[model samples]
Target: MPATADFKFTASIDDSLSGSSCWSAPSNIALVKYWGKKENQIPANPSISFTLNQCKTITGIDFQPKKNTGQFSFDFLFEGQPKESFHPKIESFFQRIFPYCPYLSHFHFSIDSQNTFPHSSGIASSASGMAALSVNLMDLERQSNPSMSEEYFWQKASFLARLGSGSACRSLKGQVVVWGEHATIQGSTDLYGVEFPDEIHSNFNHYQDTILLVDKGEKQVSSTVGHDLMHNHPYATRRFEQAHDNLKAMQNVLTTGDLEQFIQLTESEALTLHAMMMTSMPYFILMKPNTLEIINKIWSFRRETKIPLCFTLDAGANVHVLYPENDKAAVLQFIQSELVGYCQKEQYICDEIGNGALKIQR
Candidate 1:
């Protein structure tokens, strides 16, 4: 495990430094689910996820030297328009990561970001958005310390992204990533996410994830609030323990190509995540009537067709339908005929497993 001090930037920056970088990072769907957290953005339990392809955020940063104001100086834009509402979150992120990237105060930055998926479409943009911003900041840091190793670059990027948003760390690399400490996963830590070290069977390659947008409206309870509720949650301890065991089981399922076990574990994890939400001190339900309708349709389709398809939710009413690449044709057909009606305005996104974030060359 890497200590916090290891990430502190000790290198000198040239006063005349000015540059720009753009990065595109994908949103990931957690398989084991990270529902709770500890201090300093540490996960209460380890979780693994599939990096997505189409659902991503692209962020570009242009920075130039400025008088030292002892404060972060930046303007933020969303999809080419000023979004003052987003400023607080970005400001908080900059403050949290300033310790690791101390030169932030030395430059005035113009940051613009856009998501591929529709805004407020029930997809959480934090994972990809923060990952893109972190990598872009690292790109600037590389100019100050050109000798930085490739491994260190990604590790620090993941680390900084975690400070912004815990799940953002996992968006840095790999088709599958593991975040938080677990006995079964070597090199895993709460400080940052690590790529799955073991070889993944070809059976899991090019896996499909079709996101059905059930509610596009703002979440009644934000993920931060939901995570905080777990502080006094009745089943918090057992849920954490179950996450560890499920992660271990998922490792075997991925390696041995056990689709049956995969479906069971994946679906179970999703329901258990919502179960925690429903059973919390201040009980809440993120799932809508349509959310349950879509889920039932999937169950019936799978039972009749004998397809290895399953669903997962991410703290919202939206459902991510997962299936093998080979079963896409039939599964999508079922979605069109049955599940699409349940979505808000019949909105959905077709995405697949992706390698990871990319640096866009200008």
Candidate 2:
């Protein structure tokens, strides 16, 4: 684990520094969900996820020296439109990271962000958005300290991103990323996400994730509120233990290409995540009736056809249908025929495993 002191910027920065950075960071779907937090945005349990391709956020930041250095300053924009509603979250994020990136107070930032998927829906938009913003911040930091290594650059970026959104750490790099510490996984830590250190079987390469949008509206209970409920949750301890066990099991399944075990663990984790939510104090259900309907249809289709298809949810009504690249044609056809009707506006997104964030050259 990296000490927080390591991230503190101690060197004097020139007041004339002015530049910009843009990054496109992909959202991730957790096979082992992270439901709760401890302090400073640390996860209560270890979780691993697949970095997605099409579902992402593009963010750019322009920064220049400002006269006042007492407080942070930034202009926020979403899809080219000024959005004051987003200021609170960004303001909170800046406050959290200001200690580590203290140079922020000396500059005014123009932040423009846009997402490929719905903003508040359960598509992990926060993950991608924060990841992009963190990398852009890192880009500015690199201008001050050009000798920073590539390894340290991404590690610190993931660290900073986690402070913004826990899962955002995982969106920084790799097709598979693991966050939170597990005894068996080397280099895992609660501070940030790490690329899966072991070799992955070719059978798992380019895995398909077709997301079925059951609801596009904002969630009734924010993830922050849901995470807080776990503070006094009766099942929190057991759920945390279960996540560790399942993540261990998932590691083996990925290496051996055991699709059956993969399906079992993935689907179980999805349901268990919602179970935690439903069983929490003032319990709530993020899954709609159609969410369940889609799961059932996918199960039936897999049972009849013996395909390795399965489903997972992300704290919302949308369902992510997973399968191997070889079975894409069949699974997509089944999705179109049986599941599209259940989706709101028959909307869905076709995405696959990706190599994480990319820097856009100006």
Candidate 3:
């Protein structure tokens, strides 16, 4: 079911000429990965993710009505410097979502965005960045009409975020979020994601993600290219079926806090996501030598200590080590003593399931 709450507009931009909004949104690590996508950024299969804390993007947008009759224009900055590469993607996002915010084309947008973690380094930066932008757009809507319901506000933000980046919809809120329509989950739709309503044990609430950056370079194959390759993938049908089964099983695991099943399913999903890439029409491999080494060590460590520590990977070479809060000390000791060697310059980010996006005043 859609969430309902009051939206307190504590601050707003100047109403006469211009308005501005700022938001900080966290990136998410998918347990049931969203690999292939359809037209309009729809997911090929349902996926669930944990919204992470430390890794996030802060975005602020200043909007002003156009002085002349012309197409929408905007300037983008990443950490206060011109980012020409981001303009086309943002332009495409605006073009795709023009209907939802028709007034957008009539205004000029000044967007400034910055990330807490490295871009294209295995973490879902696009998810955080786009979701933050989506929230700001929603705030703009609220500025014009204060009567918008809270449920209506977030749903529209989630919907718009999905258009910018498919996985972004899941970055909205709740520790766990589900994207894509499912027969078993009610109120779940392809247009937007909804929170997982089942009982999540307290033990899993403080789950930590210790990321090991095996390679800091850009991915060999972009996620956009990889998603398109799925159209001609040999195992496309079976892959989708596997994802559906995994999602259903994960729901049970989450509710019961079955760490054993959680490790099995999550590891398999991570490997399967990369497997699809290797089998694509123009096959490509993203994992480096250290990436595999880290995975093997994680397995060995789990067997030696029986600490319930496991690993998963995003689209890049970085590895995300997931474990419960109860084992925080042991896990940190393990990472410092063992896993840190695999990371480039010993670089890694410690994160946890976060509370989604935040509105920044100013």
Where is the poorest 10-residue window by lDDT in model 2? 117-126
Q: For residues 112-186, write the lDDT of model 1, one tens digit per residue.
A: 999999999989999999999999999999999999998889999999999999999999999999998999899
Best by lDDT: 1
Judging by TM-score against the true structure, name the best candidate. Answer: 1
> Better model by TM-score, 1 or 2?
1
The sequence of per-residue lDDT tens digits that candidate 3 reaches over residues 1-362 is: 44222222333334355778899998999999989999889889999999898899999999887765357789999999999999999999988777677667667889999999976566668899889999998888787768887877788888889989988998888789999887777678888888897879776987999999889887888999999999989999999999999999999999999999999999999999999999999999999999999999999999999999888888889999999998999999989998889999898888888879899998
Segments of candidate 2 deviating more than 4 angstroms: 118-122
Residue pairs in steric clash, candidate 2?
none
* Model 1, residue 71: C-alpha shift (Å): 1.4
What order do candidates take by lDDT, descending?
Answer: 1, 2, 3
TM-scores for every predicted model: 0.99, 0.98, 0.94
Off by over 4 Å in 1: none
How much lDDT does each candidate structure score?
0.94, 0.92, 0.87
Q: Write the per-residue lDDT of candidate 2 for residues 1-362, one digit (tens) a residue.
A: 56778888877888999989899999999999999999999999999999999999999999999999999899999999999988999999999999989999999999999998866545768889999999999999999999998888998999999999999999999999999999988899998899999999998899999999899888999999999999999999999999999999999998899999999999999999999999999999999999989998988898899999999999888999999999999988998999999988898899999989999987
What is the number of residue pairs that collide in model 1?
Answer: 0
